[model samples]
Structure formats: structure tokens, C-alpha cells
Target: MAKILMITGDFVEDYENMVPFQALLAMGHEVDAVCPGKRKNETIATCIHDFEGQQTYTEKRGHNFTLNANFDDVAASDYDALYLPGGRAPEYLRLDSKVLAIVKAFMASNKPVAAICHGAQLLTAANVIEGKKVSAYPACAPEVRLAGAEYVELQMDEAITDGKLVTAPAWPAHPAMLKHLVALL
Candidate 1:
């Protein structure tokens, strides 16, 4: 079983954070969900982002997600893979030096890294997507391209995998993204 590390923060997308964490566990993988400044058992409020025939997605408060690991205690070498779930969290997480360092460590080690939606922000901030092929939420396409990665715009349920990196547009692509991540593991 692979030891997977899921990095998230407050306001993380509800489905993006919960679905993968549970699905990975159901697949026999051990996942440690963590957040900066948060310890095991601590919870982070999550938000639900849904497209309701509006010009953009709608956001609502979601369930509180619990962390199972400590960020300060994490060593990228200790995990076999990384999961980055999209939400408002990435907007700030990408700015954290520690978070960027962890992201760099995973990419540097060639470990499988799966990022979805706004999660791509961290990859861009980490400067690890250069020369890679990726797919992200449409709004994030510009950033992905600016990071030197070829952004493949696809349906919400589609996913793109380039070597050890797997990316998807949003939670709607969880099935494909999770499948690709399992293969990488």
C-alpha cells in the first residue's frame, strides 16, 4: 500500500478533499491529510463549489475536514505520493514557503503528484510544472501556461497525466484522477 500525503487548508473544496481521501483509503492506501499549523485530529472548514447555471461556480460552507497528520512532522521522503485538492485554500497555501518546499520535494523526488482545479496554483508557485503537460480548471489555464506547462483544456471529467504528475479540472474528474494516481503508485 502506498503512503499518500494530502495537503489542504481551510475552505478546501468539500468533495475534492473528502472524496479522494476516502477513495484512497478504500483502495488500501494510507492517506495522511494535513494542513499547515494544524495537527492531527484538528479540523479545517471546507466549502462546496458548484456550478449552478451561473456565470461561475457558487460557493457554500461545507463540512469540517479533519487532519490525520502534522505538517511540521511531514517529510516528503516518508510518503510515496502526494495529493493536492483544489479550493480557496491553494490561493494561500501556495504562498507558504513550507508548503512550496514540500511540493518541491515531491516533484524533485519524482513521486506521483495529483493536483486538481485550483490545486494547480501550488504547482505553479512551486515552479515544478515547467515543461510538463497539465490540465486545470479553465480559470487556471493561464497560470498553468505561464508556469511553462502545456495546459490541456478538457472536460470537467477528464484528466491528464504527464509522467508522475496527474491533473484534472475539478472534483468532477475525481474518478479519472484517482485512477491515474493509483496507476502511478
Candidate 2:
């Protein structure tokens, strides 16, 4: 079993993070979820619109995550791999220099790195997406391309592997993405 570190910030995609996290746990892998806040309970932000275009709010149990570990406090040598769940969280995380350093450290070490949706934004921010093939949410196509990566416009079922980097389009791609990831582990 691999010891995986999952990094997140505020406004993470609920199902996107939970499904894979649970899958990793079910596979007997040790999974640790890290977030920016030390809230014993975290709220995942999701977009749910009803038939009448009314916004509905729903909440689910999230990993009682650690906010105490600053990006600088974490060393890449301690973990086998890293996972970044997508959503607006990546956008915020990208701004943190510490987080960028962590991303660079993982990429430099050639550890297996998995990202979905906007999570790839951090890769772009780390300047590690160049000459790589990747996939992400449609809104991120131009950014990926600008980072000198080939972006594939497929569902997560079409897993992408470029060296140590593995990327999926969105939540729908979790199963296929995780399957390929587990193989690498």
C-alpha cells in the first residue's frame, strides 16, 4: 500500500475528492488528506442546480484534515506519491509559493503525481507541464496548452501518463484514473 498525500484548499470538489480517497483506502492504501484549514469538518462546494435553476446546498463528510502543515514543512522524500483534487481549490493553492515548491519537489523527484480538473493548474504554475500530454476540465484547455502541454479532450476514462505526471479530466474519470494510478503504485 502506498502512502498518498492529498492536498486541497478551500472550495474543493466534494465527490471528486471523496470517491478516489475512499477507493485508495479500500485498496488498503494509507491515505492522508491535507487541507488549508484545520477544521475538524470541512464543507465541499458543489454546483447543483434544480430543474427551475434553483441552487440547492448539500453537505457530506470530508476528511478531518490537517491545516497545520505548511507546504514548506512537508518534504517530498516522505511520501511515495501525491494527489491533487480539482475544483476552485487549485486556483487558490497555485498562488502559494510553498505549494508551488512542493509541486516542484514532487515533479523533480519523479514521484507518481495525479491531478484532476483544475488540479493541473498547479502543474502549470510549477512550470512542469511543458512538453507533456495532459487532460483537464474543458475550461482549462487553453492554460494547459499555454503551458506547452498537449491537452486531450476526453473523459477521465482516458487516463494520461506523461512521465511521473498523471492527469484526468474531471470527476467522471476517477475510476479509470485511479486504476491506472494503482498500477503504478
Candidate 3:
């Protein structure tokens, strides 16, 4: 069983963060959900993103997710895999130096990394996916390209795997993303 490290923060998509965490645990992997500046037992609010008959996805208030690990205690090399769930959090989490360093460590080590939706922002910020095939939320295409990665446009329910990276467009691609991710594991 692999020990996984998940970096998450407030406003992370409900499904993207919760699903993989539970699924990995169910599969007998150890997962430690951590957030910058937060300690174990602390909670972060989540948001649900839905695509109703609208031009873009809509966000709604979601439940609070509890953290099981402390960010300050994270040692990237201690984990075998990394997970970066999508949502508005990536927009800001990318600005954290520790977050970028953690991401870089994983990529440099070629450890399995699973990121969905806007989570790709962290990869870009870390400059780890340059020249690699990556799929992310449609709105993130430009950023992915700007980071020197080959943005792979995929269906909302699809995922793409390049090396140890498993990326998808959004929560709709959970099944595919997890499948690809599990294969990497």
C-alpha cells in the first residue's frame, strides 16, 4: 500500500477532493489530507461545481472537510504519491512557496501525481509539467500552455496520463482520473 500526500485548501471542489481520498483509502492506500496553515482536525470549506444549462459551471456552498495531517509536518519524500484536487483553491495555493516546492519535489522524483481541473495550476507554478501532456479545465488551457506543457483537450469525463501524471478536466472525469491514477500507483 502506498502512502499518499494530498495538498488542498478552502474552496476545493467537493467531489475532486473527497472522492479520490476515500477511493485511495478504500483501495488500502494511506492518504494524509493537508492544507497550508492548517493543523490536523482543522477544517476547510468546500464548494460544489455544477454545470446546469449555463455558459459555465456554477458554484454552490458545500460542506467543510476536516484535515487529517498538518501542512508544516509534511515531508514530500515521505509519501509515494501526490494528489492535487481542483477548484478555486489552486488559483491561490499556487502562490504558496511551500506548495510549489512540494509539487516540484514530487515531479522531480517522478512520483505519481494526480491532479484534476484547476489543479494543473500548481503544476504550472512548479514548472514541473513543461513539455508533458496535460489535461485540465478548459479555462486553464492557456495557463498550461504558458507553462510549456502540451495541453491535452479532453472530454469532461476523460483523463490523460503522461508518465506519472494523471490529469483530467473536472470532477466528471473522476472515474477516468482515478483509473489512470490507480494504474500509475
What lDDT would each prediction earn against the true structure?
A: 0.96, 0.76, 0.95
Over 129-165, each residue of candidate 3 has an lDDT whose tens digit, in order, gives: 8889999999999999999999999999999999999
List RMSD in Å for every model shown.
0.6, 4.2, 0.6
Tell me the tens digit of each residue's lDDT in model 1 across 1-185.
Answer: 99999999999999999999999999999999999999999999999999999988999999999899999999999999999999999999998999999999999999999999999999999999999999988999999999999999989999989999999999999999999999999
- Candidate 2 lDDT by residue in tens digits, 1-185: 89887787666676667788889989998776766544434443443111233353343434433333344346677888999888778988888887788788888888899998889999899898889899987778999999999998885457787777889987778878897788778
- TM, every model: 0.99, 0.82, 0.98
**Which regions in candidate 3 have their CA more than 4 angstroms from the true location?**
none
Query: lDDT score, residue 131, model 3?
Result: 89
Question: Ten residues in a row with the worst lDDT in model 1?
Answer: 133-142
